[model samples]
Target: MDNSNMWIKHKNNRSIKEQVDILVKLTETHKKCIGLPKSKREVEFLKILYPASIRNLEIGDKFIGKTDYSAVGFGCVTSTSGVGYFFHKHKIDELKNNTKDKELLEKINLVEKYWCDKDTQENFRKELKKSNPEFFKKFAKNDNYSCVVCGFSRLSGMQLNYNKLLDLGVNGLKKSILSRNKDGKNDFYRASLEALDLFLDIANHFEIETRKLAQSLIGDKLEREEVLKVSNCLKEIKKGEKPKSFREAIQLTWLYGVVAGVVNYGRMDDYLGEYLLDDLNNDKLTEKEALDLVKSFWKMIAWRKTVMNGRVTIGGKGRRNEKAADKFAMIAMEATRINKDLEPQLTLRIYENQNKKLLEKGLEVISEGCTFPMIYNDEVNIPSVASAMNVSLKEAEDYVPFGCGEIILCGKSVGTPNVLINTLKALEVTLRNGYDRVNDVSLGYNTGKIEDFDTFDKLLEAYKTQLKIHIEELAKAQRLSYDVMKENCSFIYVSLLIDDCIEKGKELLSGGARHLGGTLEVYGNINSANSLTAIKKIVFEDEKINLKQLVHILDRNFNGFEEIRNELLNAPKYGNDEAEGDLMASKLHEYVCMCIKESAKDIGLDSFLAVVINNHSNTIWGRTTLASADGRKKGQFMANGNNPYNGTDINGPTAMLNSLTKLKTDIHAGSVQNMKFSRSMFKNHINIINQLLEVYFENGGSQLMITVVDPKELEKAYNNPTNYRNLIVRVGGFSARFVELDRQVQKEVMERTLYE
Candidate 1:
């Protein structure tokens, strides 16, 4: 798969030969680990990979951790973690194509041969086939139709505990990891210790290189000064001491996250705030200096290639030091205003009785056409998470949104959205009674034929049956994924930083974390709601056609049935403030959420819930999702998150807000609501925009990702993308520069109504 699409181009790929060197070192080190313990081997590979990594000390860049395209992230074993080893089949081919040296080509071939049958997927297959053949086939089939007909991937969506890391320091964590060791017999302890030691070696190697580079630069005083400062920061952090300044804190967090490939940095202000405040109160650094450090951190986040996963949350209730956090949050918002990049997906959690000036600063940032900080409402989310996760309200304060707005408890749970359920496709397959017309294969559970459904209730039951089966199997997959990861290797870095892992002397997936919960991503939510509503109105309630006739219309892709399609389209949709249609969505949404939560207990998980947090999967999956009662063309993008399908919510923004808030919030992990505003209204009516957000939050809205732009500008930008590289827009859960998106996704964005 071409990963260039999902991930942002965050780093400058080192020259091809240099990349080859890194891969060669990694493979050579990997070969040495053949007879060693799994934990030791993985850590040893990193120790070699680190010193060999290309060290860059660019004049303007402050942060030091940048690796070649060989792979990013901490784990070297699996693509789900970091796609390390840089020796995949395609990569080897590319390397062979580029390099003329027979030696290098042979070395690359050796690397490929080493991992050919020993990689994560291959190992997983051997294990699963031996232990669970039936499930392995099902998992493979799900993968074959991934991101389209609902599937799971090793792509983990989670956040590391920045506060814990900043507070504990390397020494503190080291002591904890070895605390329970008796004669070094514990395998977890030995591996964790080695991993930490090797991790610090990576830092130590860079520190020395940066120092050497700084010493050599005599004429460029500013460059040398900055380079020396970075070298010193690395030295201080590698000494096993907690960060004493804001720069140290941010630098440590960013570098560690880069190595670990752990995106979704949780509550930046909460962790790094006190350090900034200390700097301010003690006159160690001016506000401008601190702000510059933050801006540099933001830039580094964009430069690192996490794409869609670099989430940095700030602001909200239950903060340990609200004043300090607020101050840091304000600075962070200002940084966003200054550096309008797509990464570091800066998010602000808004609440009542909070800092007004901070919010005003956020508005200033947004008014500048920055697609962040995407505002999440704590008033709705806090209570919702407490109930959904069965935790206290105070514990709920730990709730932070991970990849594409899926809510997970920071450092406490591994809520990787492993399973995906396309609710719209659930309806589509139900209509086909188990057949997938687009793929020309019979997939999913057969809930009986259209002729068997005499009433709308029966039709609804069929949809429910199909959903129940898919979600249940996927839940098993979700749990089994962790089990598999645990079998192959211990996620040393992930376990070391997250909660209860060190304390429990176990890896996170191996029962080290406080909460071993999982999440299922639901896509095409509003489109599904609209389709079901249309079906009920046109087929059962209105009686304009029977179930068989409606299925026939859908089977024909609305051909020769344009009139019926129009009628179906005219039926009540979810985004309108209409109670009946909104209620239908609410009912179906509640059913799915509740069913998932129940499945968690049945499967022996601490907690599990559904999330309507969609990335581009709505658009990606919509291509294969057959046409339905929603009036969407067979391959048109599905309704984005819980937002209205494009141009279907004619009752205006207020009504749309009303319809959006109708879905029960407490039952699910999170649901994304995307809203667009015309540039005229957003700029001229800033107060009204503020009120709209406040009222929605106060009612029941959890999160709103707003994109304010002129539709004409979007069109112009789309037509001539090279000239408008700076144009950014919110695309579902993740925001991207307008010109960066594909033509179909661009069209979907253009098709959205820019409400006046």
Candidate 2:
């Protein structure tokens, strides 16, 4: 079919189900044609679509019908618009029963069966490659000769040495391949093939589409000019020469990703180390030069649309070569000082021996509000990861951030795509009989009338029942989306980078990746805190206010009730290690985890938990939620992602960790425990940092993100603002300048108890 005609057909579809079906089919066809399952990572990239696709198909309709069957089988026949109503699963059973098309039913069944089947992935890979040999060949040859950034030639008989490779073992080749493996195979040869295949597919798709998009958007002349610039950069790098300047290098790297189908391939620290070390040794690359290069690199990366989405990690404890990674981190921090852009998101790892200068630099960036370098505490994170996977310290150190802010052992694991459910939203739905103003929708299984409930426990039971209902629905949606993505979008490049794809002949998505599970971050648990506290104080404790009065006050944002607002604020809050607040946090986390776990089992996938209240916390979601009682004025900052509200946890970092330890990690999925330390704390008592981390992890800390900064400096910076422009803090997965963050977030960072 002509491209125009195909697009027209896609746009003209009438039924939402039909539109979804077409999307699924198009995805499957795309994978079958252009996809190659070279590695487990590649497969994972493919399998991640099932939940989203399923949800899209089931959106809006409360019951499944014949149209729903068509949607999942043939693809959606409508335009990709509307309220994402395509994701609702209200009528799944009805659709299954009503569908009379045997062929369509068979296709749906096949998709479902293959969602987690390794053998199916292997077959799909072979079939896809066989269908599009020419495309695959072109994709594979796109990058020839050598490493684009370092000019490390890949020519046969040419001996090459990279410190990164040596430190990572097998010249880093095995580690690179293993890192991409969606299925857990460590063999370099097999993993390489898989990784190569996945890389080629994704790269080719990206390259072709990007070229087409550029041409259409900018006209042929401009497109040609851009292409020429990229081509020149490629040629310059291939000549076994350094760029004339840092700007050239940055431009070259950006062009390389643009043309070569590799996005942000410069492990800057790894690639420029030789030059950096030489400069460091001879005092040739001054701090200014180092900083300029960092700035230049970010500018170039920001120029490219794709590179902006890429991530960079600076420090990892117990990495193949800890010393090298640490040194590289210092260089990266130096660079962050010069350039503070959002692209090339940088992460800094803090351990017992973190460089003080580097910490100051990071804080400087944070003080500027750029929020560039997010911090990770190796003391806590390393052990936490180790305990979760039961891997060696070295393996644990290899952990890297995946989607959102979850940690995965880079070279050795395949964690699930992020699946998020707002716990407070769920509670709201239950309270309103499946209607949520918070989310502006009705989503729940209407089991019965909840008005009959006479007690808080009965109300709680209804909420739990509702939670199970939506969770199960969502799990099914996740499975379907997984299948759709696996069949449509192939992860050729990812596969090549991950381990064991070629040997297993599986893609990353279909259980081939090391960690085979899904994680859901529960939001608005603090809302529950506010609600529970209000209920206890008003109905149970004070007896002066009833449930109606409390709800009325909440609806009013406590506008006329300054006294009540103060009371709620002074009341027990989560993260203070108070029994009332801590118990509520524990109950909410545990109950939510149970729902997710049970629902995940229904879909034949492992369900895990992660607490992500990062950037999303500050953003407005749904109409301003009524004023929360946790000292938060109405529309004030919700709990900082998963962490407690700013200044709420006053006891200390230890008390916060203790509250976290109450929940059983082994039983739940994974949780992120973020702690911010002042620079003064680091210098005065590094051992205290080490001991606290040990105690936290030993007592069941699941995941940790640590930020080191000086409170005095931070407060000073907040007041004066321009004195420290380079301050950085661990903001979720990546780092950012503290001063660049929204004021509320800045307050949150300042409020984190800096351990003494």
Candidate 3:
């Protein structure tokens, strides 16, 4: 029978198990057609599958029926018209039903059979090759040669070229082995093996596709030159010697990382050991060599070549020891310093123990205006990570920044793919009855007429009603975006480096990426800060000004009212540890989080909130907001995401965290709190680190980031640009040299109070 006829026949007469069996056979045929290897991780993942009998399934209900299960989680069954039903695991459920025995067994068998098929491995390789070619080429080259760092090289002595290494064969391979034997118990060894295998497969595919595309786009002349350069480098490395120059070493290391990513499931930590500080300090390698390696690796990946979103973490929590400004960090910092190009954006984390010198070095790079590496703080962040994962201080300290500064406990836990909500936007919609007063879009269906609001209480009530409507609409938009991302974008490079994907036979974007669920980051809640502050002064205290007058003042950019603008500024603001401003911020945060929860519940997905005001939100969301009562002018920037307007918080960072703690973190999604400290703050207040950690976990902080700089230095640098060229500050999630950031971002940073 024809292929179409056979597929139709298989679809109709077969049970789910039978259909899976046929599919498995087809997969093997496809694998042979593609010439791919069988992956053990995929085989093991398939063995855990079981069919669940779900009846009368609603849109958001838990997937419950009689089924044998090993993992602790709730599974939901979903079906599109053309696609068959699939079960997605959610929460943990212990109760088991008996009546659906046959259906449960069939489901389990199908899952197992589908995972075990060799075709799955082949399909994964095909997707990786299709998506990322640079990664693949680097991997193939590394596998064909010895260690790129300490291997034989043509540039070495005349006796140590490719011919010599080939002649030595097993001896050369033995000499290249870096790890000592540990009776198969070495975690690093096992991880390396897994990473190596994965890298080879993914990299091979990536290279093939990349070369093809380059040839097609740039023509064969340029493609051949590129290929020859890479080929020559590999030939030199095969002799068990190191590259003669720093640039070649950099290329080799970069290739190694790209390959390691494929094998280790896009995990940076798994490959960190292969290229850490200790390796350089021990005289085994040089800082220039390591830096070159990372630079070359990134250059080859050409992040901009593919349209996929990319994230890079340069500094992590525990990794920030006293000498945090060590050679390794410097290498990563410098690579970013010189290469300000946009691909592979970098994130840098700041901690109490961080080396002052290293911080300055990163600042030097940022002052060049590249907006990287993004800075995160460990003093406040460690406890925040602990709270989110329910772990200990030490365990949380081990957290690493992943997927755009989201904290993930390295090799232990996942906390990404969380839902995001814009709380500030919610308030705006609520206040305007679904009409964005700033944009004048009729987003809400006139839930409450503006004319009916006779009192402040009535206005607030109308705002709350409008907030609920916008929250519902925003959640729907998020789900649609998630669906589109999952279906259209395949994380082939990430799949190789990250864990669980290969084992589960799923791609990273397809619910296989480490962290599941949604996190909403509320923007402009601080706009409510201005609004509430205005209401208290105009409507309640003075009674000389009314809502209408206040609105007009704001609309006119507070023109001809310098006295009123000063009065509004003096009105209580959020993040000052004062009851009036703090309470309003807290109430707004809680109310918005609740709206997100209610709307997200309709889709059977767990929702959380994170207040990430990284960078000056000026570039993305801030460009659109109107002048807020917080003394901001119309078409001017609003407060950074979830952060108070610049220069608004009069109190110190401690007060800021205290005010932030007023919100109910347990009830909402997740939040990102960014605080900046001058280098002087650490001079006599080293103990402040402990205090910061204490209040963060005690007050239910989710994510905390800190930037360390000298306020005097920044001021001088700003005033005399040439004098302080090396000054740097953490802008949002990345660090840039103080002079490097855009004028507005620089102004925002300068406006932040520098504690003594």
Candidate 4:
């Protein structure tokens, strides 16, 4: 192991660029960090030294270390990364023996003995699979056809309490830890204190390393100045003292995210705005400088290359420093515009009284085709979150969307969307009397054949019944999974940052948060609803074909029934503001929400909310779902989010919103609604776009994620990648390079209905 990199403790054995690409592959594959060190201190040091290369600092770079993303670095953290290695030693050794490279094989040989601490997330999952075979079987079987998914091996990010971190410096936090130690009986609190101690030790090491780097840059004036700026910033934060300037505060903010392993930043304007104000008031920092610092931070975040990166929320109702925060909010908006990187998933929280300039700035960025700062309406989310979490309206003001647009109480709750339920798959099962054609397996209760349902109501009822069974199984499995996680793994770093953990002497997973809950991802809702609507309009209302005949058409993949398939395709679809289709969409959405809520409530969760945010799973899951009544051929992508089936929203953007906003937004946690517009629309009428957004929120639209791009540009990029390496599009819940996306996803983006 080489000491120079310190983070990896070894030379790449691979090139840095190779490492960066591998890091993204690992994250996309496992949905968590790639490697897990044994101790908390080791993890902290790794974060401090990650991305392990800082030699090529930009002209205005104020931070020295940038994360290269060699290892997994995202929100979810199990107790140990390598515990599975211990249990599966033979599997590990077999691979090592198969390795052709001597060095790689030597590294793999270390897993010869199975070893892990007594309590670990890896062990907990093993236990869950062993002790609850029935639950495991259901979850595992769901994976093939992918009716559902769970956080068996990977973890998701949680919203942290940045307010607390800012208010109580490291020294103050240490004092709080000391006070908690007076109780001494709680292992959770003890672990948190120990975690904090390691955090501070790493802080000290960072200060030393930063100052040394500064010293080395003395020959170059500009580099020296930037390095010294970073060093001074580190010095103020190292002792756990309140940051005196914008630089220090931002520096600490970045470090906290790195050490915590949760990249979703909670309400940045609320926490860092005051520091910006102080610097400006004292004439120590200029507006341009502050924006530059923010831009650099944005670069640092994007450096990790997460498909769904950190979210930095700005401008909302409940910010403690609302007036002061507005200045930096505008700056943050500009930074996002300039950075143009897919990450820090810049989000803007808006209310009726929000500053007009800030709102305009955010719109301007989105109009530029950045697809950011994704707008969230406080008018709906505030009250909705309050009802969902059963907290006061004031408390709900702290609510923020983390990865892929799910709301959790920042610093007060832990709500991981650990399971995915495919509503359309359930509909398929209902139609086939519980048979899954794609996976060739029988699942759930047989709800009778489609011909047995004489009325449309009977068919919907059967679909609902099947959906309920899946939801119940998922909720029960999630409950057991979290319990095992709580028993085996200690989320020390997370507990230290989230609320009431130290105060109540408990860890995050062990009931330390003020609110504890989970979220479920529901895919194919729009497609299934549309299919149901088609069945109602064509089969029941028009009496064009019998249920059995339609089922037969779908079963044969519509090979010889092209006219029937076209009729179904032409049936009134969701997102068209048509009563027949919109009503069905509303009904299915409400039913899914109710089932999830009840199941989550039964398991003692604060709230079990459903998110319709698509993680490009519509494309992946489509491969596993057979043909449907909606004229969707086998292996075609499902609808993305609450949006209508691709190419179906024929009526324009307003009608799309009319169809989408029909849902009771307050009941479900979050949903993503994506709309694409041609560049001409922005060139023609900015006011019309603004008014459209205003009316949507007034009508109860919760969130709007927009992408403004020309279809020709994307097509050209697809064929000639080198000509436009920087072109990006919003794939689903997140954005990525146009050429880097899966071919099917790129096709989906092209097929999105473009409003001119």
Model 3 CA deviation exceeding 4 Å by range? 1-270, 274-404, 407-429, 436-440, 454-458, 509-515, 560-563, 597-599, 606-608, 619-623, 660-729, 736-743
User: All predictions: root-mean-square deviation over Cα?
Assistant: 2.5, 15.4, 18.7, 5.8
1-756: candidate 3 lDDT, tens digit per residue: 000110111112224344334434433443343432222322212222222111111112111111222221111111000011122121001111322456545544444454332222123334434554432332122111110000010000000011121223322323322234236453233333443434333334334433454355455575455554443444444333545433334333344332212111122322343335455656755766566566755554332221111345445455433242255566666777676544354555556555566556655655454455555556656765565444588866655554334445443333333223334444444445555564444433365654566576777677676556545544543454345334422323234333444344454445544433444445567766567666766665788666667666766777898787777777888878888887777777777766665665685443333434343443334444445666666555556545666787788777877777676654442345566665556444656754774566456554554556665667777778887676656555444567766677677777766666
Q: How high is the CA lDDT of each candidate model? A: 0.77, 0.48, 0.45, 0.73
User: What's model 3's lDDT at 646?
Assistant: 73
Q: Model 4 scores what on Cα lDDT?
A: 0.73
**What is the lDDT ranking, best to worst?**
1, 4, 2, 3
Ordering by TM-score = 1, 4, 2, 3
Give me candidate 3's TM-score against the actual structure.
0.55
When summed lDDT is taken over every stretch of 10 residues in candidate 1, the lowest stretch is: 71-80
Tens digit per residue, CA lDDT, model 4, 377-489: 99999998888777899999998887777888888887777677778877888988987776676754588786689999999889888888778877766676577666444
The best candidate in terms of lDDT = 1
Cα RMSD of predicted structure 1: 2.5
